[model samples]
Target: MSHLLDNLTVHPDCRHFRGDLPCRPNKTHGYVCESCPVYAPVTSRVLIIKLGAIGDVIRTTPLLRRLRQERPGCFITWLTHTPAILPQAEVDEILKFDFASALQLQARQFDVVINLDKEKEACALLNTISAKEKFGYALRPHDGVAWPQNQLAEHKFLTGLFDQVSQANTMPYVQEIFELCGFDFRGEEYVFDTHEDKGFNWNQLPSSGPRIGLNTGCGDRWTTRLWSDEKWISLITQLQQAGYSPVLLGGEAEDARNRVLHATTGAAYLGTFPLPQFINLMHQMDAIVTQVTMAMHISIALRKPTILMNNIFNSHEFDLYGRGQIVGPNRECVCFYRGTCQLGTSCMEDLPAEKVLQAVAATLPAATILR
Candidate 1:
């Protein structure tokens, strides 16, 4: 038994190696670590700590492409609250935020640790992690609040705190994150796996016209971003009149309202789905119409042409990848980043349906235009 134990060897640095079980090559072809021809070793391990609000997670995927270019032989582990939305193939391991996962992470060490989220928990995790190099936010030792780890993160940190600085800032969210990690954002496209959904078939959707997905909710947290129901009905009617297929999209929060929109405008409403299936559903559309929500980020990641309705947030913060338009209200928004409308009425009310309709026609490919 001692002799046998002495002869055993393992390669933890191999990307295919699973610490708890047999590696893929060994399981599939009985390839031992000593003589495995397909062995791929990684030079370093990296951890990405982005916790929640799924939209930010989707947008953060662009950093993966940059990371790969800079460090071709690095293995990545992502700690996220919404692990289901992340591309498993792109990342070596996706960890959901729970007590067990936190304990597991605490025991392990990484070559590089990056935390883009400023949440107290995220900063605390960054502080606890053992890494050769650390970037982005960290928990301040005295106050127990989030603080920038380095100078690069200061710009993004300040922008979030001050409305004027955010409004005057020309850097898009992607560029800011890239700079935070000491890389230039050269229009690196989002890395998303569109083939994750296996259950749904979208054959029933109209085959003639270009499918337009109208993501109709801004979420409960941001009531200031909601558009009037009357405006959505008008836009759907106009799309049908122009020989376009209008489909409503949302999560459980927006389902009842979406059903109402479908009934009122005779538009297609293919109910809410899991995150992966929701991404797949968005992939079927040629273009999308949405406010500043998860759907907007998903649409951008899927590379669909989009017309983004805006009012509360800074328009400059969004990078549409030159494939979409950001249409703000005619009346300037008084509530910049506030959740509730300070003016008693949302500025989205001033954004007319005809304007959004024109944006839709302008955004889609010329061949898809029916009128």
Candidate 2:
């Protein structure tokens, strides 16, 4: 009876908790652990280490949902730099990585530790942590280098150095992420706690129809994915003529660019807001037209019909959960995994504005003015 508590991580909700009321294999009670109320959870303290870009951090939440289902009341502590977009309800605690947090993590204990980031620092940190089961990226120890801890992780790990390997891969990011963590991807939806901005309301606007979001900026790292200012103006004008209200969406860097596009095209510019507020703004759109960026992932998580344009990144890299299309360039992408186009002109220029308008019309809510 004492061994029961020692061997299994018990759930607080179990009715027969003590040795006195131990679960029985009698005719009245099912002997199986799956149906038994007192069936102990296998996992307790789970640590998830994923740090970096807000988009990657946001998309990684689906793994939380899957992990929660496997073990009841399992306390999860996630390490990340961007906590703004993460859903608070899913994770028990969030440890923002620093020297103190690193030291704390090295000292603490976890039943399962999953480190998804391949950065040497992250891998080195994982090597120092104490856990019964460790998965994903690991350190080489002597030289302080990173490598895959398991076979599943090897597939995604190889994509970093080899272009041909990445091109040959058909696995979606979430699927590979889950595999790295030693779980199957079940088409889990992204978990996001979209906090609304107090006064930013689109309903007060003078215009009509369904509000379509035009994500006008790609991040600085992926400059090749950006569409020209002229193309954005053209798309906004076309959207207006087609009876769809276009809303320009972006961060601080995009404010000036968005202003120019808004003034020239008469598109509504929702000024730069915090990540949470930005999510609130995105939620108001009937559908979102975006490049391969964070907003696109956010729109997909919100279940808003998304129209995504891409050229550089692998088409299979995104799942979009059957809610969007991966519109690519007409010609073969000359640059892969590169920030700037070596050919002088970006391949994203080849994406026609007419094609985008058609997707907007097809996906727009019935409230929009029909063509």
Candidate 3:
């Protein structure tokens, strides 16, 4: 068996694995036995390719859970830019996207390759990988353009470009992605492994009424989705008046903006923490009001009731697990994916504070709502 070690892919970070070797290595350092620093041939392997929009990466992790369930102990490698967002227990190895990682992945053999991304770059990468079976979106013959790899993916794939098609499609995002991988979407919850050292002193927050989180930014990529600060201020004031503690949430880009919101509205500004601490912070919220941002996914993953503010994207695409409500403008969205709306009045601004407030109340647990 030792003689066969030389034939396996070697890595400096792994211990040699034996067929029956107790796998004594730190399981967190879950390198494949065949690909570990020391080598041994492993039977089955799976690779998942879904990159960008950290929120999408987090939500797609249900597939990881299903993958592990289908092939227990099989080596699973996930390729993503936001590795920290993934639960450590899901995949054995996480390959962050890059030239070196891409080369290494293309060299490996896998039983299944799942690429859920629609971007041309991810599509091209999927085309280069070797796998016995491929699912999800793949690169077409035309310059690495994206196309559905299987019939299951065709529904959402066809709707990807057209507004009416997407509006008409009722399949949830997770269900569609799962079907793409030849798996069933079984209302499987998002798995986010919490670290032991990720202890946040919950006492630091005010021991007040039901704490609600308000995620301020919609991200620069989709400026058309932004609700004005004035609206947020109004909502904050209303939350405060109604006895619900409002906490503002955002990344570093929103520091100054949050400070202004905090100063004017007196909403709690806990400031942004790293991914782990941020997760802990969100756990403290009873309910959350957010745009289609990473925080929304985190809120859903944590099982907190969420009020999703949507404008440009298809409402049918979201699967909130009956834990949330979608609040969009009263008018239909003409501009689909564009960052800025060319219309006279931004649809996001048209979304009345009362509508958002109503959604927030609806998602909150009956006990949490003061009224």
Candidate 4:
């Protein structure tokens, strides 16, 4: 069975517990209490540390659910950076920290601590956590060499380690990571709660049939992932003619591109808002048209129809999210995994505007279409 399906089969049954059974970390033979003094039945408080971009944080939520399920009475605290986008429901306490403040906090001993960062500083922080059992990714040669030197990629590497230790090669996706850690994955959904009373101003949006959100800018300036501004403008015009309001959504970095697109085609440009507000705004839209970014993942979680304009290699990861239309070149574009497209032409530019418009039309609700 696939790791995903295998996870679904093993639902936690109350009847299985026979008067405080020994805690076995995994399917391996050794029992925790038998091996060491630190393994005694203690307060099962879990500390999960994953602080990074919006997309990576979203992927880590399922792990939280899994930890909560297996250790029912355990107190779960997540250490994330300020302005970190997350689903409010998953964490019991969100300890926001900066570099200086993080080093000073009292180190309360934890039963289990999981570090998902990939930088040297993160490693130092992991060592500081007063935990009996600590789980993190094993260091690899190719890992932790990014511009910011993230230690979090180490967590991804650790997934492979766990697989090897368990004598299994197939590791589950982000969802199954949490399931294997002991959480029920069946009914869990990605959620974002905006505590604001007024919520998003729908009136600011164009009053038309089927509004579609277009995210033009990614976090970085890698041209490989970006569709041409001209193509985006052309696509917006086509969608407008097709009786769909194409609202442009992007971060501050895309203000120039948004202006260019707006000037070319009078599309409604919704500049960057906070993550919660953006999610709230998305809840009102019919579908999302984006690249391989956090917005695409959010759309998938919301179950809103999405048309992803992605490179060939990264498309597989997005495919795992399920329920989306992927638009890219017919062939394996040479810029598949490269940070920046070295080839003179960007594959995203090769995707014609009409093709994307067709995808949007097909995915949007028929009731939302104007006659």
Best by TM-score: 1
* Residues 1-371, model 4: lDDT tens digits: 55764443332322122234533442244432324333323246787776766676666766755565677767677777733466555565577757644664334677877766655555556666677766663233355332211343333454434533323324334634443333444644554454345456767788767888898876674557877777887888888887888888887788889988887898987677776777778777788988877787777767778898877344434433445588886546776455676777777777889888878877775356552
Candidate 3 lDDT score relative to the true structure:
0.80
Question: Each model's number of backbone clashes?
Answer: 0, 0, 1, 8
Pairs of residues at least 3 apart in sequence or in different chains that clash in candidate 4: 66-183, 117-151, 117-152, 118-150, 118-151, 118-152, 119-150, 119-151
Among residues 3 or more apart in sequence or in different chains, the pairs in candidate 2 whose N, CA or C atoms overlap within 3 Å are none
Model 2 spans > 4 angstroms off = 1-43, 196-207, 365-371
lDDT of 2 by residue, 106-126 (tens): 998888899889898789878
Cα lDDT listed for each candidate? 0.90, 0.81, 0.80, 0.64
The 10-residue segment of model 2 with minimum total lDDT is 10-19
Candidates arranged by lDDT, highest first: 1, 2, 3, 4
For every model shown, what is its TM-score relative to the native structure?
0.96, 0.86, 0.86, 0.73
lDDT per residue for candidate 3 within 338-368, as digits (tens), equals: 7878886678888888887888777674355
Which prediction has more favorable TM-score, 1 or 2? Answer: 1
